[model samples]
Target: METAMSDIKIIMKETYSKLVTFKRKENRESFNKELLKVLPQIYRYVSKRLNSAVANGKLNKGMFNPSDFTDQLFIEVYDNIDDIKSENELHVFLFKKVDELLEDSLVEEEFDHVFFDNIDTYSKPEWDAMEENYTQDGDGDFLLLEELDDSSLDKTNYTLNHVFITDEEKKLADKLDASLDKERIYNHIQLVLDKMNLPMRTVFELFTNEGLTTEEIADIRKTTLDQVEELLASARLLLKNSFEKRFLIDSN
Candidate 1:
C-alpha cells in the first residue's frame, strides 16, 4: 500500500512538473492534453451532481450536459492555472470551480432542503414497505455500490457493531449484513442520500465517491474542516441508523 501511494505521488509530481512547463509556454494543446487526464474524475462528479439535481427536480435534464460544465471548467483552468501553486491545489481548484458552477446553475429558489432525521422512529413495516418500493423502482446501480464501497469510511458495509447494538441486534445486523445483497443496500442508501440536504450529500459523495480527503472537501465547499467532518459523520450515522431500522429491527 505504501509503495503504491508513493508511486502515485511520484506520478502526480511528474504531471505537475509537465503542467508547469506547458503553462510557461502557453501551450494550450499540451496543457489541455495533460489536463484531460483529470477530466474523468471531474466528469463523474459533474454527472453525479447533475443526476442528483435532476432527480430532485432542481434542474431540467435537457438544459445542461456534463460536458458543458467540463468545457467551461477547462477554459477556467487554462486562464487560471497560473494562480495554482501546487498539484494538489490545482485538483482542489478544479472541483471548487465546478462546484461554484453547479451552485450558480441550481438557484436557491429551487432547493427544498428536505432531511429525513427520523430514520430511527420509522416502524419496521414502514421500512419494509419502503424497501419493497425501492426494489420495484430499481434505482440503485451496481457501479454506485462499488463507488460507495471504495470510500475510506466504508459506509456500504457498516454493521450494528458501531452503534449501541444489543446482543440480539448484533446478531441481527450480522445476519442482515450477510443476507442483504449489494443492490438492496445500495438502493436504500441512495434513498437515504436523496432525502438529505445538498451539503451533506455533496460532502458524503466528495469523500466517498471522489476519494477526496476532508481537507480537500472543505476547500471545495469553502467550509471549515470541523464542518466537513461533522457533515461526513452525520451522513454516515444517518446511513447506519437507516440501515439498522430497515433491516436489523424486528418487525413485530
Candidate 2:
C-alpha cells in the first residue's frame, strides 16, 4: 500500500538524479539507459493527461501522441533537475508543466463546426427511394393492385413539397447538426478537462486510468483519503458539466 503511494515519486527521484548529473555530450550511454527505463511511466502519465486535455480543446490531435511533449518534459526536467529537490516535487513539477503547456497553447477559439456536408445526405438516393417508393413495404414488396384504394394511395402518395429538401429544412438541419470535426470535438473536450486544477487532474488520472485506488492516490499526492475523494468528486463534476454542454445531454 505504501509502495503504491511512493512508486511514481521513487522512480521520478531516481530518474531525476540521473538527468541532473548528466553532462552535455558525456555519459550518453548511462543517460540512455535511464531514459529507456523511465520513458514508459513518464509517457503514460503525459499521455493520460493529454488525452484528458484534448477532449476539452486544450490540445489538438497532433499532440495526442505525447512523444514530443514527453521530450519537452524531459528537457525541462534536465534543465531544472537540480532545483526539483525531492521525488514528490519532481512528480508534481513534471505533470504540472504538461497541463500548463496545453493551457498556454490556447490562442483562439476554433470556429464552431457548421455542418453543411451532411445536409446533402437528405437528397441522396436512399432518402429519394423512400420518397419514391412510399408504397413499398418493409420487404421491398409493393402494394398489391387488389389492395389498392383511394385511402391507401393517398397515404402512399408523398408529394415533393411534403418531402422536398427545402432551403428552410437545410437550415434546420444545419442548426440540429451538432456535428463538428471529430478532432475539434476532442479538442473542445480536452480544453474543458484542462480546466481542472493540476492536482485534481493528476490524481483523477492516476485513480481512473492507472488503476490506483483513492487511498493510493491520497498517498501519491500526499493528501488525506477524504481530500482525495473530494478532489475526485470536484473533477467529476467539472467534467460532467462540460460533457453535458458538449454532447447536449443533461444530468438534470
Candidate 3:
C-alpha cells in the first residue's frame, strides 16, 4: 500500500511538473493533455454532487451533465493553474474550484439542519422498526440505477471503510461485511449519508470518496483544521452509530 501510494505521489509530481512547464510555454494542448489525466477524479466528484442534488430535489436531472461540470472545471484549471505553487496545491485547487462552481450552480440553502438529535438514544428495535418504513424515491432509484449501469462500479467502494472505526464499530463493520455484499453495503451507506447534514456528508465524502487528508479538506472547504476535524469526527461517529442501529442491533 505504501509503495503504491508512493508511486502515485511520484506520478502526480511528474504530472504537475509537466503542467508547470506547459504553463510556462503557453502550450494549451500539452497542458490539457496533462489535465485530462485527473478527469476521472473530477468526474467522480461531479457525478456524486449532481446525484445528491437530484436526489434532494435541489436540481433537475435533465438540467446538467456531469461532463459539463468537468469541462468547466478544466477551463477553470487551465486559467488558474499558474496560481498553484506545488503539486499539493494543484489537487486542492481543482477541488476548491469544483466546490465554487457547485456553490454557484446549485440553489443556495442552509445545509446545517440537524437530522438526528441523539443517535445513541435510539434502541435497536426502534431502529429496525424505522428501517421498515424507509423507501427510495423514483429519482433516487433512477440515479442509483444509472450508477449501477456504469461499467466501472466504483460507487460500490464508497462506503464507511475510510472512517475511523472503534473496536466496537469494527465489530459492526465486520457484521456488515458478513451479512451484506459490496453493493448492499454501499446502498445502506448511501442512505445513511443522505440523511446526514450537508456539511457532515460533504466532509465525509471528500475524506472517504476523494481520499483527501483532513488538511486538504480544510483547505478545500476554506475552514479551520479544527473545524474540519470536528466535522469528520462527527461524521465518523454518526456512520458507526447508524450501522449499529440499522444493521448490528437485532429487533429479535
Candidate 4:
C-alpha cells in the first residue's frame, strides 16, 4: 500500500505497453509475466480479505480452501484482464469479483461439502444478506468499497490546499495505543463511509487507503483538483468529527 501512486501508474503504463507491443505468443507471455509479478501482492491482499471475512462470519472455515479458491479467481481474472485499462482498474475489478464470488462459492461449496452434516442447520438469512451485499443493482452497500467511480461533488466545493492528511488526522491515526480501540474505531469509520454517497466515499478510499495524490485522484475520477479536494475534505471532516465524538476528548 505504501507504493507511490506515480510508481503504480508507471508500472501500469509499462505493462500495458508491453502487452500491446508484442506478437500473439509474446504478448501472452508478457501478460503472464506481468500477472506473475503482481501475484504475490494479490495473494496477500486476497488472503487478508478472506481472513477478515471468516472473522466476520461471512465465510465458513471448512467450506472452500482459500488458496485453491484464489487460484481459481486468478484464472478468472487472467481471462478478464484484457478488458481492464490500467493496473488500478485491474486491482479494483479483481477485488470486486472476489467479494462477489467469495460469498457464492462459500455458500454453494459449503452446501456441497456439508450437505449431510449441516443440511438441517443451514443459516439462510446470513447467506441471503451476504449475497445482497454485493449486488450491482442494490443500494451500493459495499462491504469493502474498493471499486467505483464518483462524479458528484459537494455543493460547497472549497478550494483548500492541495495537500491533505492534516497533522491532527495523522496524530489521531497514530495514537492507536493501549488505551484506544483501534479496530472498533476503523470499523465504525467504515460503517460511516459505507453509508456515504459514492463520490465522497470513492475519493476517501483513493486518497486515504490507496495513497493517491489529490491530482491523481482528480485525473482518475475525471474531475478538477478543487472538486477532489472538496470531496476529500468532506470525508475527513465527517471522520474527524465522528472519531472525536467516539473517543471523547480526554482533557486531563
Per-residue alpha-carbon lDDT of candidate 2 for residues 160-249, written as tens digits (9 for 90 to 100): 111114575444334323554434333333343344556766666666444456776666566799999897777655544443333432
Tell me each candidate's RMSD, in Å, in order.
5.8, 21.1, 4.4, 13.8
What's the TM-score of every candidate structure?
A: 0.74, 0.42, 0.80, 0.45
Error of 1 at 161 (Å): 12
Preferred candidate (TM-score higher): 1 or 2: 1
Best by lDDT: 3
Q: What's model 4's overall lDDT?
A: 0.48
Residue-wise C-alpha lDDT for candidate 4, range 1-252, written one tens digit per residue = 234445555665675555444423445555666554434433433443444344335565554444554556546655666677776666555545554555455422111223223323434453234334523222222222122112111111111111225765566656543344544444445444544445676677666544557877776666799999998887777656544444444421
Higher-lDDT candidate among 1 and 3? Answer: 3
How much does candidate 1 score in TM-score? 0.74
Ranking by TM-score: 3, 1, 4, 2
- Strongest candidate by TM-score: 3
**Residue lDDT tens for model 3, 103-155:** 77987434423546655566756654444433343113223223222432265
Writing each residue's lDDT as its tens digit, candidate 1 over 1-252 gives: 234335434555676778889989989899887776566556667766766665666666567776777778768988887788887887778889999988888744232333365565778677767656644442321122232222322334322343325675566567766877755666667667766778988898777666568999999999999999999888777777777667766752
TM-score, structure 3 vs. true: 0.80
Q: Residue-pair clashes per candidate, as listed?
A: 0, 15, 0, 0
On lDDT, the stronger of 3 and 4 is 3
Model 4 error, position 237 (Å): 0.6
Q: Report how far residue 68 has shifted in candidate 3, in Å.
A: 2.5
